[model samples]
Target chain A: MKDSKKQYIRGEINKTGQSSSVGLIIRQKEPNNLETPFDQVDSFLTPMELFYIRSHFPTPKLELASYQLHVDGAVRNPLSLSYNELRDMPSETRVATLECAGNSRVFLIPQAEGAQWELGAVGNAEWTGVPLGALLERAGIEEHACEVVFEGADRGTPKELPIPPGPISYARSLPRDKAMQQEVLIAYQMNGHDLPQDHGYPVRAIVPGHYGMASVKWLTRIYTVREPFRGYWQTSDYGYWDYLDGKPVRRALAEMKLKSEIARPRVYETLAPNQAHTVFGAAWAGETEVTEVAVSIDGGQTWAQAEFLDPIQRHAWRRWKFDWLTPKKPGQYILLARAKDANGNVQPDQHDQNYGSYVINHPLPIEVFVDDLGRPGR
Target chain B: MKDSKKQYIRGEINKTGQSSSVGLIIRQKEPNNLETPFDQVDSFLTPMELFYIRSHFPTPKLELASYQLHVDGAVRNPLSLSYNELRDMPSETRVATLECAGNSRVFLIPQAEGAQWELGAVGNAEWTGVPLGALLERAGIEEHACEVVFEGADRGTPKELPIPPGPISYARSLPRDKAMQQEVLIAYQMNGHDLPQDHGYPVRAIVPGHYGMASVKWLTRIYTVREPFRGYWQTSDYGYWDYLDGKPVRRALAEMKLKSEIARPRVYETLAPNQAHTVFGAAWAGETEVTEVAVSIDGGQTWAQAEFLDPIQRHAWRRWKFDWLTPKKPGQYILLARAKDANGNVQPDQHDQNYGSYVINHPLPIEVFVDDLGRPGR
Candidate 1:
């Protein structure tokens, strides 16, 4: 099968507002960002080339032979281990889904200031890595440490902002509790293959249930700080507006919101009337498994249950399909898929502005025309 | 040629929050709210039966011969004119679009509170009536009059609100300037025919460029008030959160926002790949005409111009078509249509939450699958 001249949208700047890229591609260089061609998606694991790449800066050129993982800061014993030493340590594999914090920003009207990504900025994959908590166990984190910061090798200045404030590498911090979770991994392989250049190369962080940004790629350093980490990405970007204690603040985005998208019956697809069609799509919620998936054929006036197509997993997306009998009279109709998680958190019907452009898990309406003379589906 | 089980969604109570009416239809009986079956839409004008209907109260029982439009309040000449008297005065016709401010509330995430209308709550039609300014001129408004309120005969107690504020009639207010516009109508005839009962029967106000709410149906009383109208529909409902003079206030909604929708390729309609297809849709901007429309086949990566199908008319929706060569390799493809109006107001890629659930003009995503075996379209 031929690849559909696939697209991998790699963001080149930190300051380029999403509205700026509405109809323009800002750059054409490397540090690849790709969207999994949703139409070609017939399986659970995303193809490597199709896995979306969201880079804060250019892909760092790393030499695995000389690379060392530095563990320092608020640790009882600061240690730096070579790549082989880390790879030789205990490892485990799991299937997980990672979505960019701003995955579906395109749906955020008025266009928030960030990477304008569509629904393709997410994927489920099998990752092999050593759990970060084991490393923290080896290093013996200090009791006073409250934040764990991950710093990557890539570094650059964000040129789009009114005041360029970078000259710093891409870095982020996790709360001590989140870092200590056994599910967080310092991944060295994706889908049984060594990490590709654009992805972290030799080693990368795989923080499941969190947006892709939390899984800091191109890893170089890990630091535990006594105070909360106020890194640029953590404080200024990747956060949502929140009112805490009656005061407005930027709350750092953590877990992914429950989301579902109708991947089949691609947009603008013409369909034949009066026949049974297999309508398929995918749905995922961060840590909470999606308990129910439903399909709406009449613009949400009604919804029916969709059968799960794959085995239920804790952190991976569930593939679902609905067998629908097309209305005999041909005309325009709307198809929408909605998902409800185990926590009773169902996909919202409207955009919650509090989420800004991130956590865009709204079940967007999919409009398609049914023509009596149209072709039959596969 | 069948009506396709035509749907007209009318609301019985004013207190029903949108989010509350999610999957279930609140009441079956009607003042009759109907949606124009968009698939049967072939011409520029929306057929009368297909036109959407919205009602806050049951249609008032009005006899045409006894109908009198009482123009009183801050006017120097308080006068009452019967239906025949107004019809004999003068008449004008206009092709205008009136969208329910809550037309596409289904697209609003978190499911706003009210009727969950899809895209059919809007339509363009030739409304025939006398200019409201002509009547206001004859009535001679007093200098102190700052607001003009129109009240319909429909009245009932709202059943859903916690504090039940009614046993009130359906009414709304327009600023004096809006009321004085020659384009504003006290319409008696629709599409060269008498007004339908579901619509404002004997007479209705056609406030061009404003939402349907301002076009009060069953015009029974017209009042030019010295103070702003603080009615239920004006202050407590149908208003957006606005910060004015450094204070948070509910700003009265006026004027329609720029909006475009891909009416064809109804959601989930499957189509064959590698072919030339005519992509079609409609766009409208209240008061202002749509200047240009574009289509994006690559998830908004690029946009191409689309040709307008009908003669351009202000205050009416413009039909547009694009000759698209479907991608050869059949996979899923997204087709997004966007419009820019004469005032440079373009369709937004994200939903602006500030507008709340009222002005939901965000470009919604329509997902479709391109299958190699799908049949052809008409």
Candidate 2:
């Protein structure tokens, strides 16, 4: 990238301030990687500013007036449509949570060689756009098609290895079954406004209940393949490698694991003594419903159920709260919380270590102090 | 406020999107009260949008081109300065944390009769403007004045207030000594940008290390008084009533109490088993410096010291981190953190309940879950 072009792209990224006001932790400047902080998850609809940004390369400078989406391969008819043509199609909206496969990679016992994200690399938003299934139906899928691949406009050389030696466009493939799910979207709007450049200007893909890698940003091409697509994002980068039966095994990443996170009383927060406080957080699952959440104020010695907030929707996280009364005694205390989903998957107490630290789900322990003073004073 | 006026003010508030993208929890629309979610404190410099907004009335629409700030009372020469004139004066910038006196009111056991805010009502930011001391020095102080009063442009009838039964402008007073402090600023910029409307467009006061009520927003008037100002906001609203020696005593709110809060591993976060996770949060004190911060992962049974991040500025928060190693055996656990300032003010274990829930500094407890599966599965 030339100095002038780089500076121009940097200017365009700065223009995002006009649309959203949520603080984002910028992980990389070139690829424009940003993550949302956990506390900003108080609202059901993640504000556009707080939505996490993940890109393989710098944002593509595309003129909205001339943007086009090409759909082809393994079909009776291939279709190429302009940005307006796709917008004119029948549209649907869904509130879904999109989490990076490495959302909590920083928590890995042995640090991983990827974005060291904590709890901010995930967000829930009301996505509005035409369903990818509708586009696929219009293109008429061939019986031999086994997978669908989505490619983005941004292209660059990935830092990690064992892939193509040169520049490659960011791409990922989904199985035919997952591709045809009604919730899969060719999203044009996030929250309510047109998608921001960081999110994928003009258009992007929204794969509900799946990790963000499947939802390619700066979307430009869609094609079907006869065999399962073997892209780097699908096979090498996002997959989990672990020992099974004393042998190493690699599995492709897909639906997010059942998980829950505390959005308030962040780590090391101090609470008031003898005061009634509400403990709240959010719980989510991949294709399953989070049924119950529990809280432990006495270091997991005792457990109490939490109440869920209204307007619980599928593919979206459920916010839960518990009213807590602090003991009269002043002392340090540890608080713990866990969630159980409809699939009978309960949040575990610990996760086995992994090199990549993908899909970490362990009970997080938070410590807070209760001051001895009951009233405010100098 | 009239319906059309209300609509216009709302439009101005929406325009804040241009200056900041931090998610703000809007408490009420008419009075324009907003709070910052605690997790957004990932960085030391709080973004403009995440800065808490507290107005007793609707935002008064003022044209920037015609705006003027008046300085009078207890001065040798009264002066009226335009925005550009103030900008041209010698200026300084300071990083300060401004917290509402009633930030954690919602956590009050008896349920305070005000906006229910959890840990999101506080934020830190770099403010740029002329120091109040410099401006006051230019005007010269009069001996009779004991208090300096700051009045804002917003005006309305406050709900459920005992005093001044009709419409009144929001105002507060500061002691002469505090007013003369070099750190007190007549601020015009937040985080290096022009102040957003919700955050006192054109100019406001920046009282370093003081509760937000002292740093009045949308400031229009500055004057000194012979006696302490007895406005509703000064005496009735932001005060505490506690029994001293079995006698009722009332104390007005002032500097923020020594406090600390967790920024990561939010309330109900899940952890990975057998992994190393960094436990991090932020801590701040009143006029004193935070000397030490401790973490308790086993319900306070064991305490460890956390490392502080660089550039720990006064009147601002210090970010701290701890490397936590999850036990190979996973089930459930509680986490806790506490802080002690240079003045020997250690975070108390509990606080006595107060009506307004002001200055709550109890340690916050966060609960997290750990999954049984040590590795990711297909």
Instruction: Estimate the Cα RMSD of every predicted model relative to the unseen true structure.
Output: 25.6, 34.4
lDDT of 2 by residue, B1-378 (tens): 233222222111121233334478887776878888665455566656566888777787777788888888778888788889999999899989888877767656767677887777788788899998788777776888888888788887655322333466777778889888889999998877788888888789989888898888888888776655656564346755443222222345778888877666666667777677777778889687887889888777889998887355789988788888776666677777899898888887776443245677877666666654646511
Which stretches in model 2 have alpha-carbon errors above 4 Å? Answer: A1-22, A242-247, A373-378, B1-378
Q: Write the per-residue lDDT of candidate 1 for residues A185-230, one digit (tens) a residue.
A: 9999887788878789888999889889898998988888885554
Q: Native-contact fraction for each model?
A: 0.00, 0.00
Report the lDDT tens digits of candidate 1 across residue range B1-378. Answer: 123222223222112223122232232246556665453455577756667788888888899879899998889998899988998988899878889898778877789777777777788878999998888889998999888888899887654211122267777889998788878889987766788887899999998788888899999988888756645464335655443222123356888888877776766767678767777778888878899999988778899999988777878888888888877777777788889988787988777665667788877666777777746632
Assess the local accuracy of residue A310 in candidate 1 as a C-alpha lDDT between 0 and 100.
Answer: 76
Per-residue lDDT of candidate 2, residues A203-315 (tens digit): 99999899888899889889887755545565346755443222223345789878887666667777677878777778888788889889888888999998887345789
- Alpha-carbon local distance difference test for all models: 0.75, 0.75
Top candidate, metric TM-score: 1
True contact recovery of candidate 2: 0.00
DockQ of every candidate: 0.01, 0.00
Let me know the TM-score candidate 1 reaches against the reference structure: 0.47
